[model samples]
Target: MKGKNIFQEKETHKYDDIIHLPHHVSTKHPQMALSDRAAQFSPFAALTGHEDSIRETARRTEAFLELDEDKKEQLDEKMHVLQEYFSEKPEIMVTYFVPDEKKAGGAYVTHRGRIRKIDTYLRRLLFEDGTEVHMQYIFEMDGEIFGDTE
Candidate 1:
């Protein structure tokens, strides 16, 4: 029994003296709002727009296609053929490259519409619906109107 009492004395924690005391409150500064306190522990992003930058970098774009001399000649011939049928307003499909405003590369877009006019000054094919495809950007032209030309 005496040995047990000695063991209990040795086990007495150092904090036992102040453990029952009241919690200290700051008098200099006012108590923080619950929301403000919670905000301190909330997750914070140090790098703003970092995720957007990464997404822009990862976004894919295609390089513009350059036509060979023979291909360019074929396209010119097709344009002439289109001009010949301009009165009929033939429907055609044209694939062209649209440059990306933000990046170096671009994308190919295929558009189908009736030809309104071939603007020689602008070097573009104008559609009846007001869509225009630049001559230099044109990759391919196809339509049932040019069946014999093929």
Candidate 2:
């Protein structure tokens, strides 16, 4: 798996054939093993996985679909290179792949972000906690940046 989503809350199919007891009989309880797997993966269930992170990137902005699916991949590939400069190198741009109701057309939707202000090449950002809000992650639903001009 390129990226495993073991953090998701989903059904687990873990099972063990047999378990030997000290002096009595052997056990073939499948539920116990299944529950064990569930517990093992539970710690990260609430944490963000790949898809979650992608969506989180969109929730922050409304212009996630400026590129088509094919183009989005191209953009994502380029954005991945571009993301290398931002702190955490987050995939925050592609989050807006889905079309929202406010948009008239489901075509390309680009949020105007001033690339000059971003220092993604350095993998650092001006944001305090390292949230590299990009054009795609802009706050405005109309694809506008909303924050300090600087």
The candidate that wins on TM-score is: 1
TM-score of each: 0.69, 0.20
The true-versus-predicted C-alpha distance at residue 1 of model 2, in Å, is 99
Assess each prediction's global lDDT (C-alpha) against the native. 0.91, 0.41
By lDDT, the best candidate is 1
Per-residue lDDT tens digits of candidate 2, residues 1-150?
556566442324232223343445457753457778788877565555988667755654333434457654554455444444444433222223334454333333333232333555663323334434344432222212211111
Which sections of candidate 1 miss by over 4 Å?
1-45
Candidate 2 stretches greater than 4 Å from native? 1-72, 87-108, 114-150
Clashing pairs in 1: none
